[model samples]
Target: MIAHSVDDPLYYLHNFRQVLLWVEQRYADLLDPHELAFMQAFAGLDAPAQALMVRMVMRKGELFRSDRLEYTEIGDTCSALQSLEALGWVREPEQLSLEQLFALLRKDELASGFAGLLSRPRAAKSDLLSQLQALAPAPRPLSEWFAQAPVRIVQWCLQPLCDRMRLLFFGNLYQDWSEFVLADLGLLRFEQVPFSPGSRALQQRSEVDLALALHQCAERLEQGERPGSIVQALAGWHSDNPWLARRHGRLLFALGQQCERLGEWDLALAVYAQSSHAQARIRQVRVLERSERWQQAHALAVQLAEAPANPLEVQALQRVLPRLVRKLGGPAQPRRRARPAPVIELELPREHAALGVEEAVRQHLAQAGGEVHYVENTLFNSLFGLLCWDAIFAPVPGAFFNPFQAAPQDLHDCDFQARRAAQFDACLGRLDDGTHHQAILDRYAAKQGLQSPFVFWPMLSDALLTQALACLPAAHLKHCFLRLLQDIRNNRAGMPDLIQFWPEQGLYRMVEVKGPGDRLQDNQLRWLEFCAEHGLPVAVCHVRWSEAA
Candidate 1:
């Protein structure tokens, strides 16, 4: 891997070349003919051409003006564009639409180009576009639109091909070439997990095509496309790959939610029924209930409650089952109530309102003998991340495919802990033998600044780590870690807002602060119950601001 610096003129080109090399080495078997040809052709290009190609690909839009393609390293833009144009990778478009033209041109340029057509030359760019669009002018090349304009517009034709390469390298469309620059600049750092020979995010070419197709469907849905249309389009596509299957299910789930928002209950039910997402069934039940299909909702709710998917589902079921029973005219079932956390009431000065509720509470609770820090979910998660660093980063197949991942791909999967049971057991074993303290401290020191899913490095300090380790019991840590392993996606959040520690007394208390008119959220309620069950000292601090006399 090549490290990039601000002084390096060709840093982006280096990054693009690294991605190409990585894809060629790992995904050679999966690459199609066009992609393969692109790799070969790109490799054979001259330095200036390669740099110019990368600059366009890394940029925001496909359309580029000749005047704007300026680079000091690549001496002549026109000269560099020759090889690219010859290969048909970049070329002048046959015609540019009104919208495309408006996007490419500045206000001054638009006024100059269409001086005769504009009703008001002094109007804003938006008004100019509206005026021109109302005329319904035919699309034409820049040369025809503005004969006197010096700049020529050319569109990069190879964006889709380049996007496919990027997708293969990053495993998703959200992360792009900027990751390389961020890593190079020391703005972001990722753990180095050794990849096995078979470590690939997508095993088959069909999976790659399916992933891209699914992404397009998601974009269409977001753009207000009908849920039924998207559902119909998704009907024929299916993937045996778990990762792809998960993506498919999530997309369907999102579409289902959108349908619900639009009051299309039947469509919501239809979409949810086809989805394999964990919460899809519950959503289906909710939709059925809303649509007045009480019997069906009751039946499905009963089925799910018999063997819930996870704690979150169980929690949902507990809330919905009683109402569903009443709606169906069934016998009333006893509602199980969560044990309430101890409460602390306080009336503080209104002048401290600027500090925010959590901070104000922390300040009020701070004493000479005790310290209060607004840790929220960071402290426990960080400790677990540090102690279980090896287990989390263990080179499991499919867990890690690329070098830039902050966490394993399967971190939220149901079998995440099951697959690495022995490793996690070893990590958690240190707690039982009283070695966890030293292990956490050592890991914190060594792995500081390296990205981890749980550790918030900026908020965590040596003093806090020392105080926490001294005050927090190992048993409590074990319980929290075990719960986190149960359902990492949901269980890792909803911790109390502040923690009060007394190093001298070797005691600590977690506090959840709620200001006037505020209430506990479901996740926060679950955490408080968990703490109560495990005999952990935690409290709910309700704060009210005093009125001025």
Candidate 2:
């Protein structure tokens, strides 16, 4: 009945028959031919034992004690049943009568001879098959091994197999080796699926603005376009507005990465500086370190390390700190001694000569107000202003040449001219506010291109909100914020600067509305330094009511 079907039930029945043959081999020496035949049929069986064997053979596969029959029925007759159950098979046995046992014993002393056969060392596969042929009237050893072996092994041993790599791992067989083959094949299959765009976007979005920028830069690469100008523009705008800065920063970082891949060191450093995203920034710095720009990379690493504690900030710092320290420790650095300060007279834009940071910024609301254009000179201008105010000052140390110090002759450098032209084209390609943002995100996802900073401002603002809120806990602050919003929505109160205090330590925090010009002003810098020195938390808030300024 078992042999008639191809299912597991038949498979196990065939397997049990082989175990019976191996058992017979163990008692071969003690058996007279006639005695062997009687015992082989039903050695110790009573009428019940004969009936049970008939039932076992009649069923499809192996059976287990306690599967249907209880311990009381099979009892001692199926002593090996428990072991077989653990080996993934079932069992049933019928009790043998005393007369049957006597008849079986007179026929063959099988178990005694079987013990001798078991004492011999197991033969190798090819040798064992040869030995099986010599042992006549016994079931073939090769067929028995085939029946008892695991299905996977049986298939491989009996069938021819080939692999593309021409890697013959299985030709050298040891126990459990076939399992290794299956595991390797499974892993190879798993790796064949292509990466999805949504998953790539999700994975990259630690800093949304930056991620988007990288996405754009990657798209540009795919399209065979240059990303450096977009990167520099973003870096130029970062400090004045973090939101916009972050998007450009991301783009620059992505571009810098491509530059690094192309062996453009100076370009990569510039890109790293513009990326507002912490992860991209870290990656950029690592590129700097790899290029052996140790001092610059170290300075950047320190700023990243000291960035306010958020998950991304903390993780970025942790990842690079050990490597940064190791690089710093490797060589003695030649310190450039401090130089005498540059005496620079302050010259304001002719339009706002007398206005301070606050007043200059307030002018943006006026009809004649000129928005500040971030130029290479603007950075030096801001630095020069800060120095004059004594809020913070650094002497322009003696150096052979400041790369940032523009020279009339250097303007003739074709590379620089090309860069400027590319930036101009990028700026001119700006999209309308709504259309541009989705375009930027789509381009970023495809790793193809970037949007102009004007069009990218919305994404930047979102990054700022995310970046700022991540610094404060919502539990104590959110409820108060919502209440203020509710009051404003119903026209019950005017929007007010937020100021909160905790009585326990007399700790106070204040938020003040300011324009970008005010935040960048000398007085704001003074106030910020004062607050920092006094260990107070003060937030300078820049509110934008319009999508475009």
Candidate 3:
């Protein structure tokens, strides 16, 4: 015989007395103390007796399935029934019933009535046949059960029978499973089952298995179908399967145009955003384009261009390449120049070019590894161009920015006009020192339509110098410097340059104010050389880089 051990609380109750008490409290009516004890004894009598013990217990209720017992053993059930009778507990209540038990409890005189009253009469062989026959022809369909019965009845019957009910409403509905019926039943919603020993144990096991299954599903998705399948999966599940939201979003993106064909535009748009692939973004742009929303499409396209390109996204873009080319003015033809490198003598669009002088100075400086000290509206370009070479060749060791600090008089005059001229003179003056003479000479030659030895260069070459030179004569340089200070004082333009140093890296320095790119007149070059010969490292620092969003 296998060793019997009580693993549960029920196992601890050794006597019929205690088992009967448990059953009484547990159910309406079933085991009596003496019958329970006899069953326990019968359990000890080897394999043959164990089968009898089980039947004795089954006599008390309608048997469904129970822990393993061989009901087929010959005469096993009979022996157990006889044991019950011998104990004077479960009697053959010949025609006796529930009414008799009630009557006796009310009377209290018929103690013997208690034993027999508790036992129900055995069913006749003919009655069993009738019951089986009745059930055979009337097999109930689930549809009728759901439609005819109250919703509450189904909810109560289903109620996630175990913690690991392995079912979701929507997912099941997609497959025409009864989960939809469960969800449709009006009732309180719950994220997890309420606390109960059986429920908790079952839930723990169920959740573990669910997590594993989802992981496997994810792996399968990577190996098999495209994202649409995942979306379809998510769309089917109920609230109980809350994990599908993100997966659904990805699928919506993958399904792409087919979804639009299916009239699932909203779902597609949502997936485009949620998906990991950049293709989704391109799809969004296409959707907007197809709708003829030009501005929105343009903005989205720009955003797409800014992002790092990926193959799928590239494919998406290629699909709409013709449309993009058409919208952006037809494939960007290169413009030919009448003159290769124009000189600074002509005053062409001075105001328009002048407006961007400060930006020009900043860009030149950034490329040259220098900083813009101050930009005014005069001779600043010459100074700026010279410093750009110095910075590119010999950059400073550290970073410092002091564009606004200036002498009181200079600070009072940095208005747009004042700054342009001042900057023009400052640029010319610094370059004349001959330290950057070779580069400056090359640059000046380039301005005179000479090509550089270097193969390629940015298109904005000489833009800073030419604009500044066009803004002035010496008189204007001085006038603008003074006016620049006034503008600074009045808050029209920013503050002026007060720093006096080699814009590159040196201890001794001098004040150098930048001027607008359009003010670099002829005399400004001579004045700049004179300043350069006198040991003042005066120059304008054209910037080439600045903060971006």
Q: Count the backbone clashes (under 3 Å) in each candidate.
A: 0, 24, 79
Model 3 TM-score?
A: 0.21
Better of 1 and 2 by TM-score: 1
lDDT of 3 at 374: 36
- lDDT, candidate 3, 8-64, per-residue tens: 222222322232332233321223354345445544554433434333432322221
Model 2 regions lying over 4 Å from their true place? 1-219, 228-249, 330-549
Residue 288 lDDT, candidate 1, scale 0-100: 89
Model 1 steric clash pairs:
none
Query: Tens-digit lDDT track for model 2 on 1-549?
Result: 012122232233233343334334432343346435543544444433433343443333232223333223334534433333333223222332222222222112322322344333254433433443345333222224233322111001101111100011111112122233233322221111122222111121133333334444555666767656555434434333323333344455567778888787878766666555445666766777878887877788788667632333444455566666677785444432322212212223544534533344334322332221212112212211211111111111110011111111112111222323443223223321223233333433432212111122223333322322333233223222222222121211221233333433334344444533433333334334434444446555453322322
lDDT on C-alpha atoms for all candidate structures: 0.88, 0.35, 0.35
The TM-score-based order of candidates, best leading, equals: 1, 3, 2
TM-score of each: 0.89, 0.21, 0.21
Q: Give the worst 10-residue stretch by lDDT in candidate 2.
A: 152-161
- Residue 503 lDDT (model 3): 28
